[model samples]
Target: MKASPTRVHHAPARALLAATLLSLSAGCTGASPDAEARPQASCAYVIEYDSRTYLGREETDVPVGESLGSATRPACDDTPGDGDDGEGRALMTAFAVKGVDPAVAIAVAEDPGAYRLVVADTVTELPPELRKVTDGS
Candidate 1:
């Protein structure tokens, strides 16, 4: 008797093709893999006084009756107060920056007076007083 030829299996090949097609279709959805990792601009407030600026990540972080200048360290320096006491609470400005990198935002927050210029172009809208702080007025 002649030896029978082995039959090739098509199931695994079909499954692999299906998986490849599925993955290709999923990738065609126009969503970037790093979209979630990208940095998004958010509402950040800045307090300007004596030609210096302090950044507050949240509005509540820098209330209108606290002083950020009293803190000896930068991390604790975002009180956002208001008064004529000549501290960092002289002026409070709220603004949003669009398309700003998270690292740049942090740099601005750490030292607004120095890093404000880095994101000057990305500032969305600003009050007249904020203009002074950005413009070094």
Candidate 2:
């Protein structure tokens, strides 16, 4: 026996309704609105491939979309203050970069590389003075 058009439509509608109910039920499990909406912290770091040297680092709480141009800020403090691990603070690495825009980090990452900073997302070019560190000199 074949399913009637009405039966098919009803089946699909019921499936959709079930899915919607499941989602609604999940949301009703009781998490605070703020907790659910809050962005988690992330880690950010820079890789240099050229003769770039940083004396220090500093962080500015700029809006996520602001163009982070060539402004040299002091490096973060030796005592860990932000984020996890407490490997000490290092400005850019101090904050949770979870919600940070990629363009912003990309702009910030370019300050050190004369040739390139990150190539293909997996490998970042080593700093020029860091040749000995990579055996690429």
Candidate 3:
């Protein structure tokens, strides 16, 4: 039997369409290969405490279109006081980081020295003040 010209023309188109559909289906099952390694979007906040007292706080948002950036600020309420004078008030520092996780963020905000970097699971000391050195864009 002789193949029709129309059938031959449609054969290639059908094969291309099938291939495209297959690739798209595989992608829908789960995230891309690089998705696991990519950084997630998150916001960070700086919670300042003075001798275990809630002094003040600052929110630092990642710039639009960026995934991560350093955030720092000096204490806003630096009033002179002993804060709490219990038998054990182990927290005295004024600066702490409170990153994205809800529970952890709340704990950090309430307690002293709970710094979290939203991009990773590691915690470190409070970041240095990122002072504004220039006023130009």
Candidate 4:
């Protein structure tokens, strides 16, 4: 039996199409190269009254090492009878700062107030070593 000429040509076309698709799909799976190259912007942060150990990033251009002066504290809803007035509570306050110089971070940490250094882009919690420093332990 003789093979059709059209069938031979179709085999190569199908292989080429599959290879192109596989390459395109692989490119989409991982972090973009430019994402690593770009620097993220730093923002000012105020710690909530509830979680005094970690700093939450705020959308402000306040320079590092400067006080976040006059920022409103996060409401303490979980505390009993704390009320919306936010008084009569022990009131924890800290600034979790990231993407700043080490010296600046230390200075901020050394402040008598509560402040913790968090890993960049992951403001979930303060690292143990930083917690010790901030806590003055």
Candidate 5:
């Protein structure tokens, strides 16, 4: 039996496709050394710092060691209530953990930083390790 022209072409194409898939799978499993240098933020949550609370979900990556601007008009109150009230203003020196009722999907803070996010009736802190450290230096 003679092989059709399409069959012959497909044989080499199949091999090429298999090789390409294998390479892609391998790359996905383990990142190259260069890619590891810059770690990517997988999740984000709201953070209240320096008398200002920032909605982490709004930003792709949480700003660490940086001051976050007020996301609301007239600024948010510094009373440290359950999240923003929309009209309260906050000073620039106070730092507190304001619990946002809405479960804002957020990744864990890198290091030496922590925040609280409310999911339903439960409040969760990412990277759990942050709790181990004390309030003082």
Candidate 6:
């Protein structure tokens, strides 16, 4: 007797796809050890130094000499809170980790560098490594 023509089971293919996704997820989580507690503040923050305006947050902005204070650059944001507030926290979690556009990042600040920042809540001190290094601090 002859057998009828039919498709074979796709279980192996489906299983492979599942395994790949799981491995990818595991790798991502282990990529950064300090990623969990780190603040989700915009790495793309705007900057205004000595009347000169610049785009994006710079690692060298926070002065490590002379004094310690917050608001190294005026951060004009509609969501005032830095992922510590209700709205900012919710927006970050819903969109980023979930991989869904549950919230939209509105143009929070217009003319970003034009505002003055009053440091409150936290006292930001300069990093110890840059104590002797002066970039017009």
What's the true lDDT of residue 65 in model 5? 30
User: Which of candidates 1 and 6 reaches a greater TM-score?
Assistant: 6
Note each model's CA RMSD in angstroms. Answer: 17.3, 13.8, 18.2, 15.8, 17.7, 16.0
Per-residue lDDT of candidate 6, residues 41-65 (tens digit): 4433533322333342222222211
Best by lDDT: 4
For 13-104, candidate 2 gives per-residue lDDT tens digits of 89999999999999866477565344344333333222243221233222223333342323333334434343342233211122332322
Runs off by more than 4 Å, candidate 1: 1-4, 32-137
Better of 1 and 4 by TM-score: 4
lDDT of 4 by residue, 22-130 (tens): 9999886547767534433333343332223334332232223554432233344333432333332233322434344332232233235444443233334545544
Give per-residue lDDT, candidate 3, residue 54: 23
Which digits, one per residue and each the tens of the lDDT, describe model 3 over residues 1-137? Answer: 98876764678889999999999998765377675454343222333222121212232322112222222333333222335221322332222222333212222212332432222123232222211111111
The runs of at least 3 residues in candidate 5 whose Cα sits more than 4 Å from the true structure, single-residue gaps closed, are 1-8, 31-41, 46-137
Stronger candidate by lDDT (1 vs 6): 1
Clashing pairs in 4: 55-96, 94-114
Cα lDDT tens digits, model 5, 1-137, are: 98876754668889999999999899786366676444454333334442333443222223223323322213433333434353443322212223222232222332245432212213345423322222211
Best by TM-score: 6
TM per prediction:
0.20, 0.23, 0.22, 0.22, 0.24, 0.29
> What would you estimate as the lDDT of candidate 2?
0.36
Candidate 3 residue spans exceeding 4 A from truth:
1-8, 31-137
RMSD of 4: 15.8
Model 2 residue runs over 4 Å out of place are 1-9, 20-30, 36-38, 42-119, 122-137
Backbone Cα, N, C clashes tallied per candidate:
0, 6, 0, 2, 8, 0
Model 3 global lDDT (CA atoms, 0 to 1): 0.32
Model 4: lDDT of residue 37: 47
- Model 3 lowest lDDT segment of ten: 128-137
Error of 3 at 88 (Å): 40
Candidate 2: lDDT of 121?
35
Stretches off by above 4 angstroms in model 6 are 1-4, 30-34, 40-42, 46-83, 86-137
Shift in Å, residue 96, candidate 6: 34
